[model samples]
Target: MAHRSASGSDRSPHPGRSLAGQLQHLDALRRAMARRHSLNPADMRLLWLLSDDRARTFREISEELNLEQSTVNRQVNSAARANLVQISDDQPARLVLATKEGIAAFDQDVDRSLNGYRQALERMGTEHTAEFNALLAEFIEAYRDIVQPDEEP
Candidate 1:
């Protein structure tokens, strides 16, 4: 059965064409980034999260990424093995922070990714890109409200 919106419309407010295309583009981007950086998507996400110089527990990462504890643990372990992250010896929970090398890698990856985006934006022109970004943000906010009606703005 097809899902109907609150307005009793058969059409979904969040159409698959827009959402799926965005997701597909993101996945492809991630794949290309992973190949270029020699890091898996999970590791990429972990590195990105830890790039801010803040220490985080595995639980925090798991919750923030909506990933399973075991999966987070595996990713953390892999990162540690790669010397990209350091795990503290705290009693109950081990705090994780990115190593200098990890930070460097993250910065390089970000530069490359941003350059790609900048090139695309340049092709699209500044005004149109700005308008698209604003509209995308608005769409996301509206969709979030629809999904979680009790969510605070």
Candidate 2:
């Protein structure tokens, strides 16, 4: 049986179609987050990594963030210029640490992001939200197994 979507288009029951729709929705959510939040995803991830206040070398950050060394260097340079983070001059390996401004910015962004999630969860209800969370985790693990199989077991 064929079902019509909101725009009067046929919604197929094929698994591929369903998966594609879900992926599209996820991408849209990512875009929305980037638009609404002050920081882009790359910057946000870097900041969160440094949020622990533990200084890490450029190579360590590049590996941790799964970003190229050049990209990491550029971001670190940008952040340093913004005064959001600091780079140490400790000999051979300089470490990057989040400054007070960086922490404050991250905290504010977290609150905003949390509130968005909170509102959505409230509308989804406790049971549905829990189920969604479980499925999302499972989906991520399954996808990772397919792509990042060479990494961690």
Candidate 3:
């Protein structure tokens, strides 16, 4: 009978490495799908931003995202052409608002993307699922702090 290696050092999957790879892969897939849907990641973000507010100006989005005005303007124009959003001249600011279809699309995409993660969690058992979420949440917080930092009220 053949015997397997009992040594713990042989070949074991590193949870950290696996999770990192999965996160990178998922992010890439999301970006690719966004492009395929005739929207970029920034466009999706713009949709989300406008979903709540009736409108916002290029300057507002630029400041919020820390992107240049020209870059944000171009993204808005592209989204506008796709009918995912509409821009209008308003008193407060140049209004940028998501169309009804755009809102629905964003909602659907979010559900679809999260569904896979939900399934994986279900299969991972309760204890592991909780641990995984905690780790992922920690990483998310760290990332947000790195990118956005602490903003004063």
Candidate 4:
């Protein structure tokens, strides 16, 4: 059955793409990028999150990344061992802060990633890129609503 949009146009719910396929493709891309940089994607994400010089607790990182506490703890410990981050004894909580090396790595990865994105955007052109971004945002919002209907704004 075709789904109808707000504009009363009939369309396939997922257009020509399947959500599972798209997710798999995205994961593959992430894995390839991580491998190219010799970094775990999760580790890279954590480093990116802490790149702004802001200190965060393990719990905060877990919540921000929607990851398990144990997973966050393990990643944090790994990063500390790599000297990518430091754990400070801040009163009752240990705050995680990105080290200078971590920030540099994050910046370098971001630059590489953005260079690819820039080339892709140039190929796609401004109008199509804008439309794709808007659609992606809409899809994200819709998925969020379905996944966490009772979540607080």
* Candidate with best TM-score: 2
Once model 4 is optimally superposed onto the true structure by TM-score, how far is the C-alpha of residue 70 displaced, in angstroms?
3.3
Q: In model 3, what lDDT does residue 46 have?
A: 84
Q: What are the models' TM-scores?
A: 0.77, 0.81, 0.69, 0.74
Predicted structure with the largest lDDT when compared to the true one: 2
Q: Is candidate 3 or candidate 4 better by lDDT?
A: 4
State the lDDT of candidate 3 residue by residue for 37-127, as single tens digits. Answer: 5455777788778878567788988887788999999999988888888888856678788898789888777666678668878999999
lDDT of each: 0.86, 0.88, 0.78, 0.86
Residue lDDT tens for model 1, 1-153: 466887987864555667789889989886786688656667779998998889999999999889999999999999999988999987488899999988887778778778888898899998999998999899889889999899787
> Which residue pairs collide, candidate 3?
none
Residue 60 displacement in candidate 4 (angstroms): 3.2
Cα lDDT of model 4 by residue, 1-153, tens digit: 888999999987775457788889988886676666745677788998897789999999999999999999999999999888999996588999999988887788878877877898899999999998999999889889998999964
Error of 4 at 20 (Å): 3.5
Off by over 4 Å in 4: 1-19
Choose 2 or 3, whichever is better by lDDT. Answer: 2
CA shift at 12, candidate 2, in angstroms?
7.4
- Whose TM-score is higher: candidate 1's or candidate 4's? 1
